[model samples]
Target: MAARTHGPATTSTWAPPSGKPPLASRIMRATWRGLPAKRYDVGWEPGLRVPAADGGPLMTDHYFPRAEGDFPTLLVRSPYGRGLPWSPMYGVLFAEQGFHVVLQSCRGTGGSGGGFDLWRNEAADGRATVSWLREQPWFDGSLGTVGPSYLGYVQWALAADPPPELKAMVVQVGLHDPHALFHAHGALNLETALAVGTGMTYQHRGMAAFVKATLRLQRRLGEATTAQPLRGAHVAALGGEVPWLDEVMTHPDAEDVYWNGASLGEVAERHRVPTSLITGWHDALADQTFEQYDRLRRAGCETSVLVGPWTHTSALQQGWPEVFAESLAWLRAHLYGDPSGLRPTRVRVHVGGADVGGADEWRDMEDWPPAAVVGPWFATARKDLTRQAPADRAPLASFRYDPGDPTPSLGGPLLSRTAGSRDNRTLEARDDVLTFTGPPLTEPLDVLGPVSARLSVSTDTGHADVFTRLCDVDPQGRSVNVCDGLGRLRTDGQEASDVTVPMSQTAHRFAVGHRVRWQISGGAHPRFARNPGNGESPVDATAFAPVRITLHAGSALMLAAPADGAGPDTAANG
Candidate 1:
């Protein structure tokens, strides 16, 4: 199993000229002189405490220009430690450009006080933190926020009802709703949830401890995921107390007030700041990032999005240069009134497959899911993806799904493990997974936005899990998954005619000579819980049965991709 990238890619669409002024530059600029190379000597003030409403003084570290003058404040709040790259890159990097960078550890983590309750108190806490910054003599009231994951969530929490002094926001892989991450399809992502809970709770155990815990996890993850009664599996595998993990186990629905009330979507109607979102096609929270951006755009908040061929950690894997210059350019425009910082491209997505030298390979679009060339390539009896639907209704495809021996998850938006695209040749060889291949493309096919499939099926079990994968098949027969999704079907007795499973979104170009492939399966273990075929929670269930699934001839895979640059009749019929 060779590692491949199922995520976003870099672009050559735009680059800033060396020592050139802002506004006229590359899409993902590598070099820039817009901000002075060094505007001020850098200085750091650590352990500065600010009074929270109920919690202990929130411990913070400050980075600012040495020049004696008030500077625009760039605030980043996170449960992650506020040091090194987190502080130096964001704090000193931006501070050297004549801005004040303030990094604060959230309520319980880092040097901050009080118990951690996830995102429960972030909105109020964030607002209070900003208020404290206003009292500082060196802060000019102009503020912007940055950071990915938890840091990203803090921005939205504050932006729900932004302060009058709030000027701009740079949201990176922000998860708006906890439900979206915890329960992707009414099933807990057992392995991922455990890793996250342990990491967040035990990260403060010092660097050596962190490394040991990570190595331990890598060694025991396989056994932990398959544990019976997964309720306390993390404690046995990770050996740490993570309060929030139990909450996910107890409440699987996002409708719970605990989860719903903390969602950015719930308060999105109140968002009133100019914002920019950055994410990868394969980011764990890609859907959430795009969904939040859509909501923010509809709410009349000036917003833009930039998606690259990368994973959740890729943004800051080594350095956040891709996002660094982008954030600085955006914040300068919105906060400092630098007209040159306004990026005209509302949506910039990378085109993968062929990496063009000196070019960004990014397409500038006004909106997502390009207007023309959508298709629902109907499934046929001969195991082929055809542009035409099969007339025969009697030919049905069948597969047996056994919960105990579920299909393993392969790449595609995974967390903790080595992610991105992995060659699917071996996974596809399984008899349980159905394969449907399309004829080699005669023209380049550029896919953008979401992917979906309508399966005409019925199952003996009360609950059935439908997992479908869309892959790009090269001439050599290597089927690499690009986008995929899972849908959990339920019934009182009657199985629905067609269950629609929504695959993850992607922005890749399938060059001519390559074929498109679809893989239909019953489950993607750990990524999604296996359907027991009987009514039993995975937490304490012991019995399992094989589910017989039938996909009638009318089944089809629906996709939305641009043909020849948004030309007409691009819908896939076969």
Candidate 2:
């Protein structure tokens, strides 16, 4: 689809205001002044307050051009302060593209005066914000939303209500279920979650207070104090102390509260907006994006999904420009009555591995799960090694899991820092990790979606931990982790086991010279809270001795593989 434009301009007409100022003010003024000077004229207007459903007033900052015409509004509802760098960047860019951009600090955040309650009040507040935007003097009554992570979660929350003015949305790396995201994976993911959560706390207090408090905390308690205290406080102060975080630690089972907040499946069926979701293939939350995409398609919602070879911060790093372009095209088509090459259903992904030259490519399909594949791979274990193939009987393998020196996290989607350069060679050397591989492939094998492993296992103790990793063993013998999945084992059925644990999906091509391998282990430390190997005790129990875990090779650790001729056909036309 293509939209018509008037014509190209031939002029050097726009100029910004002249001034020098403090850094933060300079950054803000530059953004406010420079963004409009190029293609859009940015101007701020005050007195915008929408009444929350509960009678509280919700404050908002509106950014639009001086043009004397009504245009659709692009709304961003964030718990983080609206003036923050990441939040404002989206507002400036979207405003430059001709939408009336409104950035509202949700509930207690920023200039908004209220106590924060996480996602509880977002639905009503978001609807109130949209209704207010629709009634504005220059509003066209059409609205679209965009944001990453927490901000993205608000978009979904608002859409779940199907607000009349809401038309479409772009959500990047947002949480679908708080339980699954923050705790369900049987590990803390403490660093990344805290980095984001504490960042929000810092934003809520303005820059000055945030920095002052930060320095004081550092001096009093040491540099790590700021991050750790916030995390500890969040867990301790959780309403009802619902044991939300602790339950995640103690009960790794997906029951009760964990299932309550998981929203992707529900949002897909309830929200009717045309949506675009972007997530990193390596992201800890990548499963949410994929599951949401599938649910949306099955529910008959218009949607597009993109998974790239980037990490969690892809939006600010190497892939941002392209991500921006795609998002802009979607907004233009739906918001501005312009449509140029926006597809109805597609999943474009960046393929990673030593082969395929590491590039992104688009793939179109009528539905997710692709309709052309079969899932069949069984676990095969011999000695201490495990593999996946068709199996009619059981297999076993064994390893010891020591809580003190548990496996450490290398790199993945949930990590705060970049582990791009770190290799997995050292991790493979540990006795606790079980590694298996197929002979070097004779041709390129492109893996482009979610992966799962099935294991028939029994532990020496009543409980155990399982970590399954997919890796690429290069011709040089280096093993690089591409994707991984994990589960905590409790054999008495108090917790779930034997079920397939889905790992994060990825796009990678295994070259003829490389080997496709799976590494099964007990834990990945720091990235996940350590699984104190004392079988039946609560995770917080401090006293425990390590236990030995055994995997029966004749029947356990099955690797599921694509059916015959079900792999990607490189012989076909690209």
Point to the candidate with the largest TM-score: 1
lDDT of 2 by residue, 1-574 (tens): 2343433221113222222222453365463431223366555543357677676767776766544455578888877675556434666566656777787877877767677765677888888776676556666667898877778788888877777777789888766676666564465554454444445566556666556544443343322222322234443222123223443334455566645554535877755788888887776667888878878878787788876666766654566665777777677777766766475546666557633454445444444444233343334453323234444434355678886666766776663555332578888888888777767778876675667666656666666677888788788888887888777776642222354556666666778888877777887765565565664333344554565665543333333334465543332122
Cα TM-score of candidate 2: 0.81
What 10-residue stretch in candidate 2 is worst by lDDT?
Answer: 8-17
- True-structure RMSD, every candidate: 9.1, 6.0
* TM-scores of all candidate predictions against the true structure: 0.89, 0.81
TM-score of 1: 0.89
Tens-place lDDT per residue, model 1, 18-122, is: 221112112123243333366666666768898766857788878766655446788888786765346555776787776777888888888788977877888
Q: How close to the true structure is residue 554 of candidate 2, measured as C-alpha lDDT?
A: 35
